[model samples]
Target: MVSIKEGNSPDTETLILEAARKVFIRKGYDGARMQEIADEAGINKALLHYYFRSKEKLFDQIFLAAFKDFWPSIKSELEQGDGSVKCLIRAGVNAYTDMLMKTPYLPAFVVSEINRSPERMEGLLQASGVDAAFVMAVVQRGIDRGEVLPMDPRSLLINMLGLVLFPFISRPVLSRLFFDSEEAFMSFVGQRRQEVYAFMCRAVLHSSAL
Candidate 1:
């Protein structure tokens, strides 16, 4: 693939990153080889090493970026939004699904890597910079105002995340049973941008309104 450059050629780091994302997505972390990444970037292994001393480091860079896609900087996602409980849930589903729509393997990659190293969870969550208290406060306000159900904010977040990610993670199986082909499965997901938000309405919005 050609490196997307404006007037000048893409820098070596950008090429390496883009190439690494493709290989990591296609091969997963375990299966991706540094040499393969080098070839993909049209660079020699020595130069690849010069840029990223090791595969783990390169994967770390990509993994952190991918994690951001799943859960963007908490400040940006949490602070800039409507802050209503239902709107937050709806936005999360939309952001996650939209992100996965572009990179279908991201959720699977994240799940695999996290499971491969459960010890990293604490540091990863810490690195997220998301204040649980702040998010709960948002949920609490919704509850107080009767805009949200009396549920733990964390549980609601998990369920909302699952609703968005599971479809992408299960795409292959879903294709076999629910849809006739990968194309059809993705088509359904494309249509789900609004459908998933509407589903969130039932969970947080009053049933009488529907």
Candidate 2:
């Protein structure tokens, strides 16, 4: 039942899930096969079916885990404030960007699956209880206090997500076109904290602060 434990152990369920995530990322929903997942997990198709029943069921389990893993980091990061709106936004953006970098395929997987499966998309929305309002309210406070410009809160949140997430979503093209190597690509992304902070500041901060 526990999926956190990795490596060779008696936890067939966890081993299956771990293997399935890798296969899903590598092959995607359309390309991923149950046999491939079972092979990756070092188990036969029969054993894999015993636990997951079907590729669709296996996907649902992985998708749920993926969405569940993402939200908490966002909530924790957005909730922090370092006494300045610039710093607060910076912290949140950095945390989110870093999380995406750590899990490179997650954004792409989500983007792809959302377009391919309407039912899976609904499941993702239901499973992921991410509160956009928290970020909106925090940014709104800055606008209210005249610390930020009177931009629409929704636009601000969307812009923040785009700035941080877009790079990850388009990593293959970005890396191939601009970056010389994988390390360089990662280094470029790593530098986006200040870049995004500056972008947000110029967009919303009219004329103030460090």
Candidate 3:
């Protein structure tokens, strides 16, 4: 896990995007300022503006970068294996949890922006190459083979996502309320990769598959 502030090997655009991602995760869309991103990247605001014209454009680029970084590997993982419903769930949970652990603020940032500007985010998501229908089809195939219980693919998808997302999104309250320290909270979150996998199995797997 390289620090966002790693070696000066990255170009100026890469620096701005990494800096903007940190700022956006900390301050969110409306709250973030271009100057703050420049300061984070140790560049002048004029230079930052030279690269990205506006905060909206910067935010979009950051989200797109995250989606690009995330979706491809997970897509490969989902495409592999026995193509079982449980396998799909396992791959998704494991991949998402691992990514969230590395960038814990990502889910909250994405969710916040979507609520703030769903139309814009929808366009961005459409560009992200997340094949939801393919994932749903995996579940449908499992049901067709009598491997999982008959369930609405959409509902099952939402169920799996909710299980993976809730803890990270609710981090502030959950960290304080349920755990003594950030370390404890993160330890629990690390464990959730397996926990979520087991929970999804119980939620969707048929008796024989279980």
Candidate 4:
């Protein structure tokens, strides 16, 4: 007879986190339940608590990881390279969309969590070291180089993220209200991935006279 391991073990923490991620994405933070998470993890309530003391604690861990994963690509892209603003914007847009596509639920998960607890997000943002201030440094350099027109870098950053992320975050409503089909919505998003970069490049890089 082959020996088999029984019940939940230390490794079950990883299983719990995975299950938590799925549940959180599907249900959002306010709607998720400990019992549901335990069921999803194929474990009992006691084991769930053994891995994560509470739902809030579990969410905190998951949210921090998600935030870290989401922000770094844009940060690195902005911080690196000696290219023009057009090049930087295009690269950042592509990188941001690629990251979002790979983690489809991430935007909704983040927005839901932040809406639930803005203070918590503020603290996390402060600690993350990738805020408007850092992005502005990159944008200011472009302005100083005369590579881009004068504008509030933070406003531009916000607009860039909003354009790239809002469609995905509002996909269900957008699909139903406008596209009327998943395929149409997906196609639109695919097109926007390139269009967004082009729009940003044109808006930021071109002279006002043009």
TM-score per model over all chains: 0.84, 0.86, 0.88, 0.86
lDDT of 4: 0.78
lDDT agreement with native, every candidate: 0.77, 0.77, 0.81, 0.78
Error of 3 at 120 (Å): 0.9
| Model 4, span 1-210: residue lDDT tens | 324354546467888999988898899888999889889989888877777788788988888888876774654665566655665677678887888778866888788778888888667876665566655777777887777778877777788888889998998999999996999898888778778987776777647412
Supply every candidate's count of residue pairs whose N, Cα or C atoms clash at under 3 angstroms: 0, 0, 0, 0
Each model's Cα RMSD = 4.6, 3.7, 5.0, 3.9
Worst 10 residues of 4 by lDDT: 1-10
Report the candidate with higher lDDT, 1 versus 4: 4
Better of 2 and 3 by TM-score: 3
Return the clash pairs for model 2, or none: none
Model 3: pairs clashing at backbone N, Cα or C within 3 Å: none
* Cα lDDT tens digits for candidate 3, 51-161: 777777778788787656554356678677889887888888878887887878777777787788777756776798656778878888998999999888888889988
The lDDT of model 2 is 0.77
lDDT of 2 by residue, 53-107 (tens): 7888888889888776564355455455554567667776877777776797788
Best by lDDT: 3
Best by the TM-score measure: 3
Q: Could you give candidate 1's per-residue lDDT for residues 58-128 as a string of tens digits?
A: 88888888776766434466566667776676666666766777778888888888888888778777776
Candidate 1 Cα outliers beyond 4 Å, as residue runs: 1-10, 73-82, 208-210
